[model samples]
Target chain A: MLTNRRTLLAGAGALAAGRAFAQGTGAPIRIGLLHDLSGPFAGAGSVPLSVGAEIAIELFNERGGVDGRMVQAVAADSQSRAEVAINEAERLVSQERVDVIVGVYSSAHAVPLAQRMQAQGKILWINSAIASAVLKGKHFTHVFRPTVHSDQYGEGSIEFLAEHCERATRIAPTQFKLGIIYEDGPYGVGVATALEENARRVGMPVALKEGYSATAPDLSTLVTKLRRARPDAVLQVGYNPDITLFLRQAKAGGLRTRMLIGHGAGYSQIDRLTETFGAEIDHFCNVDPAATQMLDPSRLTPPARELQQTLLTRYHARTQSNDPPTHASMGFNNTWVFLEHVLKPAVREGGGSIDAMRRAALGVDIPVGGTIQGYGVKFNPPEHEMAGQNGRSVAVVMQFENARSKVVWPTPIAGGPPVMPLPAGSPFALR
Target chain B: MDPFLLEAIVNGILLGGVFALPVLGLNLVFGVVDVVWLCYAELVMVGMYCVWFLYTQAGWPLIAAFAACLPVVAGLGLLLHQLVVRPLLSSPPITQVLATGGVLFILQGGAMLIFGTDFRSLGVEMPPMEVGEIFVSGTKLIAFVAALVGAGLLWTFLKFTYVGTAIRAIARDREVMPLMGVDPRRIYLVASAIGGTLAGLAACLLVVQLDVHPFIGLSFGPITFMICVMGGLGNMLGGFLAAFLMGVIISTGGFWWNTEMSYVVAFACFIVVMFARPRGLFAR
Candidate 1:
């Protein structure tokens, strides 16, 4: 009787295991989010980006979680250190065995994370590290970027300068001399190089290209040099501290130009910038990855608006802050794309295999206005030598007026008209 | 001289004055205790945060908040002296250095954990005072004047006051000063308090101009140390003068070349001066 009972239990356990395996729902899908959750970039970048990922996971799970199998999302803080990011990535992939890794704030952290993910044959949907080197001449099937690249930021900046500077300052595009100042780092240098390349392409003259340490005590001398150069406009790429110090010193030293534009980084931090400078931040322009819902409400597509509202509501409910955070919008949109286009497809077609996911990601061909950020998802193939970059992702230029930052470039989707020439008495007016 | 060159020089001088204020206290503690408070910059950082919390968050007036920063920092300085610096005073200098270094990490990491690394600036926007073509930022000028006055007061106290004499005597001969009826431990504690007060003043002045963050102290730390070394360790006046000179050199270097080159030139000047005068440029 005892032998018969033991045989029956063993048979039942075997049948349950086989049934679950046959249904392709034996184990839950694990997603890892790596971010600088406690570092310098946390307040403006990482925190919001993580929220975006969380919101995506929540919505995806709510919709039945990749073919009836529950999805698990886990996050680890990089502490804004590259070594920490490496350790976290190792744990996420080797220990937790996550299916996908998403969100890294800095290029220093992102580069190593990307290499690790590729070696592990997993997917990495880059949230913000837009260094051009990450994608140029390299094709990693597992590494894909949904946000605008640094080079694109440069190109977008010059294009905006040519289109808006001429109208705002009444200076002809050919006559305008652009002064470019960038932090001496990979992100800044890459963007600056792109700015120069695009300036040459658009027939705009670059008067001075200066690179400075982000932590330099004062920028008076740099401002003095730019003043002597007498550029009609100045373009800068810098981190938060550098941008804050530069603007303060420039204002103190009375450095004036027709137009002043920042290509992402510090400029994209709208709430922090306003808190620090109040009205002083007005009249400046920033060219950054476009968050379509952040533009004037009327311009947002209904679907995009709904997604944005959901993200903001979820974020506000969690953090209790007044305004919707900046980096989360991109984070949510990027994760959403991966879930909708890649993960669900792979789970259905190939039993949740990574190779299937990669193939699905490559074949993704969503048109513009389909994603929450108003960008399409079409990864370039090896023939284009741009295998993993989102080719259609375009950045927008925003102008700050009366404590409001609104997209004012790419006329078709502009939030408002660009305020040109700055008022005569303004701190940034052209000499 | 080109107007811009002249402007850079003037701004450099003012920047030096602002830089000097923070280093003066570090100079004092390093001199008397024979211990390098490696966490000196973090002391100033803590003071800045105190000012921020009291003024910005609590809705206290700026001056009152500035005044509140002093006692709080003084208490912290006293606590640090008792807890960390006092115990290792007799150990090897390396032990003292490492202990203080631990304090630095604790304070920085603590600030990051507690306050978070969001940039917080004192929103005192006094317009620049324009005289002809020269524009002087009101906040910077106020800091410069405060530094000058604070330096003067510190000089008078050190030169004339009884406790100041005891502190100096302790610095000159720590062993003999106790025999002279002045308690060395007591003097060190008092000196630490004074140093904390100075940091408080510097923080209050700087918050008007510069933003406050967790690792901000690191940004200002090395250069301030360089200034102290160039001024002659423990020599207040020397540090003060060296700061302005280095500031001018850096500003002019930046104007003529670039920002990194300016720092290189400043470091080069420090090396040349140290090699030529082992005691330092302004060391008595």
Candidate 2:
């Protein structure tokens, strides 16, 4: 027993010694967070993403730093332009010599930056942005994304609904009137295809469809057209304002339906839309991963849970604001995932040069936020898609209810039953 | 297909009346000034953003927001003409194109820096108008009627007003117009100013229908420029006619191919039209 106690103490001592580097170092080791601070996505995409990313870097330092080196995040706002994204990425690499770069808001910005990542030999950590094309090629050799791709969002939505209906016997597969009311764009098109295919596999027929321009002056015409089809559910697609326009039009039209689901626009600048629509959005549905659910008080992994809570508490304390729903939590997890899984291990084995770190970043196994959804992340060499079964695990069916959105579908992580008998003929419902 | 195609065409023509504000004024400038006035397309963009800035930010009423867009954007037009157009007036056509191109950049840049490229849409407080499953917007109908009336008023001014005739006279004979009691500079100013004001009005109407963004101006600029050139460099009738043709092509292409390609199809058709009838649909 004495020997065992001594061994345990020695082990504790060894672990303490081991944590000096893992705890973060005395000197700062740089990570770069480049984002659109003053451009289109600034409100939801740029500021919140950057703030969340910053909190993560701050948390790393407070934990004795990553590998005993203070994890410093040097940030630059790309202004949501491609040239600016490339320029800031170059600056981060040359001036700061950052180990990782996080928070790009547009696919237009990400595709080119991915190419830059390959050439510079650096790790690109992607969180939330919808440019489906980013997952198409292996150009960004040093990048790893933990979020679901655009295509999978639709597929996941269909799958979730199918699984739910099968359990509840609400709608038979044959009569499932799946419909799509989508923005006419590439990302929208990809999602549309995913939904159609997935719905078909579940034996549901996509009955009604319309592709409207996001730039349309008013969505009334589209809403009227969508109403004509009288679909069971409509998959309303677009970015922030598209969602807003559809919701407002649906409300004014007094259209009701079984379910109303927005495309994966839940984590966007949805606050504006919520403010405008008021309680009307309570019945609305949107697709965003249950990232925070994984960080719940009960289920956090040893190091990860502590890290999650520390960052959440410290961030709220410093900002004097509530911890962002999943915004900061994703950033914090993404940063830690990049460092703990890729950077530190590479440095221990291969000296953590830019090339070494890039190589290691490729081999990461991403697990979903256990408290959120069960998406454990893994990537295959030359396989660029950041989604499939594991990625789908965390996709919680979310509804905006009572002035706040919560996971309301696929129990186990769900807070409440879906508000069934959703407002009749919901223009934004996905069939 | 239920003769809805015919109605779509009729409504498409009616829609052209509203869109003519940009085509007519844009071509008017091109006819006399020989500059494309790329920024003219963005005049509507400026108007929309200004309205959005007022309504959403300053909490102004929609009508007030619409009212404020005109004067502010009119001043913007005057500044653009004075600072940008005047500097490049004597240079080659390429230089003139580049100068007006700079205007597009400045306006778009200002919008981006201020607004950060998020979308801004407006509520008209009216439901969509439908005639037996033919879905159309109440806001769009109003814009069309307003556009038709505005276009007619401009047409009357061109035919009857002294300054308008002088402006027309200058378009016909730029160098010799001074003998006809027309100051080329004043005519140019009036043309650009009128063009700018119309663009601002269109901008307000557009925001009520769709969201506004700086990048959206880039999307609008090239197409309107094409409309002017494809219709005929300086001919209003030609500009008006080709506007519908291009719109139909876009609506069809957006259905058949892809959204981004709507611009490409219109531009490509412009190229094809230029190849078949190099002078455009109407002879200048």
Candidate 3:
């Protein structure tokens, strides 16, 4: 009896020690992914982003996660509400105890959530929100964004226009009259402000600038205004419904423009637009991060090419979409960067402390064509105006032809020359 | 007038046409049943989804799908009346309103469960028609003409048919209509079905112009209610006229200022009208 009791005690002691060892070394790294998975933003690239982030984490874990510790993702829906996003972020930090939080789809939600996460001193890696105000002049140490910003979208559109205006439209860049219209939200306002500023810097004349509610039932009056202004090209920023309304109204009002350029959001869903407007939107140009699927594999690093292939294959299997939207690449590439570059090294250095994570993030330096999206990874230092922003991240202008997007700007990466002034067959084309 | 301003006015009238059917439906239900179906717009949303499913998914012809939408929505209206509104007919107006509000959430949640949040478009567009200096959307013009025809048919039914006369009588005097050998319950059900049919008609028109999502109703719902109130709650003609007036105001406001401000101007106009009339613009 004495011998049996002693043996039981020994077994219990061994089990306790083994559990402690597992807790200390083999525990999974918890990442909180906050995105609008079930709200209005879901269809506007949020779902793709969530799916992409999940895929990246899955791939990382399959390859034997950060330094032998598996990575886990805790996803919370923002419901497209800023308050909900903040509350969920707080829960993920205080309750779920996530080491890093990533993936916010809307700038409106990102603005407040970033501030909250920064105050809490928790690391927040932004995957998709693009408003320049999200990082501009806010030298945040804990927040890092590795995707194109709204200012890039603004500048990219103008640059594309300036470079290709004379050649394609027979209109000088200086004489080009640009019309700016946008939904009066943070994303739209940010892009519109940047577009106006960049256009002014380039000495391009802006014919009309208008802001409308995204939920407005009628855009006919705005269409009438556009008709009156008759701008050489119209730059619009809006989500799905408003863009559709504007296009429908523009067609009805015969609001002719030399070209119609859109910045991300609704514009990225070229297939949906094509399904609606058919050939009318064939040459419509959209400024956004290049979908990695559209980029030439030869230009990307060997690893990046493989990653792109895997992402596309998995994404297509999941979404049944042949052409993966740009958001998927942004989500996958940014989360992959965080996991491989920042989290892995941080854990290796010292138990994945927030400070160590910060150091690892700052130390990341990759040249162009290194990532799946063909953008490099180099966060602006904390001392910089837009600290924690990926300064090297770029946006490209892509034209939709036959419901497929082809990059047409930034000469180095462009698949083909832009079709400017639209084709004569388009109703919006200049006669 | 500037041609642009003229264009805005014309566009406003066209927008008015879009608002007319929904306003008439709401007014019709309020007139006969005396219970506000706050879920009216949601019913329209469901009708839109039905049409989209039949036409796009089930591979039915567009016109056939549209024809099927009317009866499907009318049956839904009958079910709603039988299931929800009927039980609450004896309750206070506030209670009825709350019940229908609950139904609104149910419908929205159900749609979310089924269709998800993806915006589904019918992907049908008609070319613009040029009328001198004014350009008009072919889709909007068709919707406008259909709304007028629907309104005319409704007026004809009310004036000529025995059942329609009974519905009118119930709206006129709910207490006395029972004494006049007309069953108020049957009349209410008929009015509700007709209201649903109008909503379905509006849905058919709207699906072509705008993409249909679950929350698409919120875009035009509030304005519709305001139009109903402005025209006098039970007065169909007043609601019809008010829809156009509101449409012109909103469109012209958009013309003068911007789209967001235009809605503000519209609501402000509604407040001013309410302050002056109290009951409605055409209570008598």
Candidate 4:
């Protein structure tokens, strides 16, 4: 009970020791990883995407994590449903108390989830979900997407057509008749609208535009419509099931086009399409952010190149997929950028507060070819029209040749010239 | 008529042919067993998986795979009867519906565990045939012919064979047939097996057109039930006719409007039909 100097000194020393220990190894940073782990989108690319994000977190943690604070990923399955994604995201933020949330596979889910996160003032780092509407005009200070948007996808395909239509198909760009067909979902609608608008801007004639439910039992009627319209090239936007159904019906209904371009989603599953259609999809092109593995190693920065290799090796080991879908690269690259660039600096500056993270994100200005996807990182300012969107993300046009994806557009980074009019023997090819 | 409109009508008829098998199967099960196998489309999904496994994974010829699918699905139907439906036959109708709905989830989860969610296609397509101003899908044509053959064979069986006649009699009057020395239970089991065999046939046709996935049953299942109910739930001929009618409406709707709007039109037509005939179009 006596107030002795020796006892007081001992108590103070113990308190100091505990505080020092806490300061040296701070509390683990919790990241909520929301993605469609089951249901229809799981097979589409969501599973691999979530796995890729997990690998990034695991790798980061292995390297002692940001500022000696281990990153903990609280994974939740959206199940390819918007309601589920919103609920899971709410639980992740309110119950699990994650510092940041990342990885939304479907644009339909992301649109609502992003709004909910923005309203709640929680940070959301989107690794996928390419709908331009997610972050187009309504600038959310906390929501950021580093991936190419639907506008980029639409523009890339049109630009490729404009540049090479005459050389490949012997048709001038102005005379080429383009047809657009899409599933009537947020993702499909977003891309189709972009395609139509961009096509008109380039003076390209659109022969037909049709929207159908992705779950429609038969697409034969749509195929027949396409046949009647007689478009020189067709641009399709759909998920896995609808894409397969459309192709099958198109083949069966004798719908022929000089060329076909698919915008991401189902188009990224080259292996599955090949399994179903064999050489039929040989010249089918897709517009998406470059799959990290598809890029030349020399183009990426040294650190990014190493990260790319690590991601591919771990991804193949995890998924047993020799061909990594673009979604996987998106998951790994975007998450890595958030960790190495945003979270690390934010933690050092202000103990990783939400505001600190936002400042760090906006402050990022990586130049071209800085990331594994060969895209730079620079978020548009809050005052900008497309706030929270990555200003430097790029989309490339890639064509499938013998079940392998080869980048064929944006000549500087392209692996080869676009195969126009599709080589003979493709079922959809013009004779 | 516009050539494109004609093509749309032809495609609609072919689409109706695709819907016919499932409608007939559901009608048979509902008519004879007097219990709705809400998992009927799930049965077809399983059959699809079976055919896909046999042809693609096990390296069986497509025909052999189809042959194996029928018996496998038939056995599954018998198992459904023995394990699920039979136990709840004496329970309320609502209880039976719940049980079958549970089976739907079980089958879906089981398929998901076994096959994952990847959409698997049979990867078989036949070239399109050009008929004077229209293009006909070779695969749909084959499926249409096969469906007609399946319906005829089923019709012949019902009209000629003793078991089939007993089954029909039981469907007509469950109490009267038992009084006439027909065992309704035995007839129900045979009807379930026949229903499953029809589902297998439907699976064979659908696999060539649509990719097979665990949740694929959701795509066409509701429409199949709609067709069955529209035609008078237990009326096989009514269901057959209704399938064609609905198919034409959908195809023509799509031709006139857009793909998404066509479904809207079909659903609207269905609502109107239901309101006009609550007991169904051919209830008597």
Clash counts for all predictions:
2, 41, 0, 0
lDDT of 1 by residue, B1-284 (tens): 68778888888898898789877888898889888888888888899999998998899998999999989888888888999999888899999999999999899878876776677888776777777776777778888999999999988998899999998888778888888799888899999998888888888887777788877776778899999999998877788898899889998998888877899999999999999987778887
Which parts of model 1 are misplaced by more than 4 Å?
Answer: A1-26, A119-122, A295-305, A320-325, A382-384, B273-279
Better of 1 and 3 by DockQ: 3
As for TM-score, the candidate ahead, 2 or 4, is 4
- Per-model CA lDDT versus the true structure: 0.79, 0.64, 0.87, 0.87
Ten consecutive residues with minimal summed lDDT in candidate 4 chain A?
A: A1-10
Between candidates 1 and 3, the one scoring higher on TM-score is 3
Two-chain complex of model 4, DockQ on C-alpha atoms against the true structure: 0.39
Error of 1 at A112 (Å): 3.7
| Least well predicted 10-residue stretch by lDDT in candidate 2 chain B | B2-11
Candidate 4 Cα errors over 4 Å, as ranges: A1-26
Comparison by lDDT, 2 against 3, better one: 3
lDDT of 2 by residue, B1-284 (tens): 64334334444554465566788878877776767777786788888888987998799988999899987777777777878887788888888888788877777777765665456656454565656645455666777777777678778888899878987888788889888677788888887777777787778766775567666664456667777778888898788788778766654454345435555776788899999888887865
Q: What is the TM-score of chain B in candidate 1?
A: 0.97
lDDT of 2: 0.64
TM for every model, in the order presented, reads: 0.91, 0.82, 0.93, 0.94
Winning model by DockQ: 3
Best TM-score among the predictions, by candidate number = 4
Superposition error at A41 for model 3 (Å): 2.2
**Native contacts recovered by model 2:** 0.09
Question: Across residues A286-398, which tens digit of lDDT does each residue of candidate 1 receive?
Answer: 88776544565444567766777787777677566554445767888898888878888988998778889888988899877777777777988755666688898878887
Q: Over all chains combined, what TM-score does candidate 2 have?
A: 0.82
Q: Can you give the lDDT of residue A70 in candidate 1?
A: 55
